[model samples]
Target: MQDKDLPDIVDLVREMGAFGDGGRNRSPGNSNSGYGQGGEPQAKPAPGLPAQSQAAPDLPGHLEGLAARARTYVEAASSPNTRRAYAADWTHFTSWCRRQGLAPLPADPQVVGLYVTALAAGAADNAPGRAAPRSGGRKPHAVSTIERRLSALAWNYSQRGLTLDRKDRHIATVMAGIRNRHASPPRQKEALLPDDLIAMLETLDRGALRGLRDRAMLLIGFAGALRRSEIVGLDCGRDQTEDGRGWIEVLDGGLLVTLRGKTGWREVEIGRGSSDATCPVMALQTWLSLARIAHGPLFRRVTGHGKKVGSDRLNDQEIARLVKRAALAAGVRGDLPEGRRADLFAGHSLRAGLASSAEVEERHVQKQLGHASAEMTRKYQRRRDRFRINLTKAAGL
Candidate 1:
């Protein structure tokens, strides 16, 4: 009806309500977009649906829901050592910044340059909470270490929505200067030779549980080229871990360990040794039987009682300590000062031992070590075929 229908039309519409609206056409752009008119009773919104549009989900609240699943992804993205290093690096930087009365968030590039100058000059050795100046004659970090610390800074800044431009002249120029000023060959950890490993094994008496466990750990770590973390992360079954790295299995020919290292999952085979005394599998089996460990972490702590084993897994550091103990007991590096000798042995010695001693192709060694590249594996091959590729011989000099 037209607007001129006036009071009578309004009275009629008001009295009749919208009963006639079902036959009328609604505008295309209207929210309902229903076939019928304005006030026709709609079907119960396809059952269990609201008549009006429900309030939209909170955008930020939806994001909050992702935090738990996102944390799982974040934790898996980097190794534990990497996370620990990142924290330490950040702490060092922030501590230094506090000593200098500087704002750490929006870091001043000049301050960063000064920080590197201090680090290169061995300022880290001084007493804490004291401002240290750059000095020329002091121990400095390896080039690799300095660069990694810088990366940690950049990463932390990124997490806080701030950009730490490492390419900025402040960082790059100072870093280059530090590299040149403190230039030195990389110092690698000492590798345990096969004879040395044998001697270390002899140090552990086969009669005791701790000795049996250590023997197994040393052999398995060396044979499998496992890192300290991987050594302690093994389980009896596949995918049976909250943070456990991988699993172990016994086969007819050898023992198979599927390990997740820095390079991801890879298999390591430790063939049956000639004798039970040196065999990794046999030693491991002895420990397993004695400790009564089944279907959980391969290595764990034993009580002071020496025979009683705890459910708690061994710490990664314990591997290093065990190596140090074995090395000392075996007198493998007697010529060096006691401190220097102690410093020489660590968990890495096992991995390096396999690399240096294995009479196999570089590729095989690389695979066993879980190194992504042969070049990386070569770094750990201390004193191995050093002059094998003499250019003079190749050139017929």
Candidate 2:
């Protein structure tokens, strides 16, 4: 027969409800609407369509939903820093969800538990070329890090109208298991001895512009318990170095410092000196005069014309390097068995040192350092505890 007169193979198959090669139609019912015929059932529907032939339900967009909910919770937080931290933590959690084939808006409790486990164990389940999950190498996350991540996850989920119930046994079990694990040791505090401070002071030429700036920087940092950012953000118009009678009024007394703080703005007071003096007037006067700073950043870079340039503020990392170089020049040891080099001591050391020195009655060091709790300040206090004990011994106590 001519090809045009021949019946189509597809039509013949549809009419017969079975292929010529003895293929049997396995469908359950003879619906007759593109399905079964005679007493036999039809073939299965195409893969993309719903198995039961029903319309798919629409769901909310994943990232859009997460962002809206995250914004509301973050805005109601106590401080800007907290907002930023929670946002970043949530972002990380969502990224983890994407990696695990889960939706970000409503993460499954089992998946959340797995992510926490991965973070604590320091490795993901899908590592390359491995028969099983492997360790995350030497830098495995600490128990505290894992705990914080879980907390962030829980907080995020709570914001999204979801509750991770204890009935979800995997999450509960993982959290319980982690609680039993020992926490990592606390971090060591940074301290500078009197001689070490003096040595660093002596290293500055004092005859030169940079030397004067360095001297002033160190003295102010020690006297005011100022954070690196606080010191760097100091404006002559806002931060008063001295009162009319020449007494230094550090941290605006009760006024909020608009400069650098964990919460963007912080209320701080000048800490008492080692001699229990309320004012650090002498240190303030000395720095202003030596640095020749009048109306700009108190600490600044020296210019080519031998002038102190106040255009740029010193960054925290620069402050750390400067401290380290000064330490080395002053004959201070940089190497420690377990601790990092002296250069690793950033602006935080100044605040920590002040907290350590201010071991007064009933006044917790955490208050001075602007820490959320005493436990945080204990880390710094422990570093300087030895010096405090030595000073007591020298006093014949």
In model 1, the worst 10-residue window by lDDT is 1-10
Question: Candidate 2 deviates by what RMSD?
Answer: 17.7
- Pick by TM-score: which candidate is best? 1
Q: In candidate 1, how many Å is residue 316 off?
A: 0.6
Candidate 1 error regions (>4 Å): 1-65, 123-142, 393-397
lDDT of 2: 0.52
TM-score of 1: 0.79
lDDT of 1 at 28: 27
Which regions in candidate 2 have their CA more than 4 angstroms from the true location? 1-91, 125-138, 151-172, 205-210, 239-297, 300-312, 328-331, 334-339, 342-344, 358-367, 370-379, 383-397
Clashing pairs in 2: none
Question: What is the RMSD, in Å, between candidate 1 and the native fold over all Cα?
Answer: 17.4
Per-residue lDDT over 1-397 for candidate 2, one digit per residue giving the tens place of the 0 to 100 score: 1111112223222333222334334232322222232211123331011111221222223434554555445453433334446556765665555455564444468777777777666554344332333443535567777777777666655643357554477788887786678465656535664455667777887667776667666756655566665665565555453211012234533222234456444445554335412234444445567666666565667778756555665664566677777876666664553245553455666666666666474255565566777676666663455654577779898
Error of 2 at 47 (Å): 33
Question: Each model's C-alpha lDDT?
Answer: 0.74, 0.52
Tell me the TM-score of model 2.
Answer: 0.57
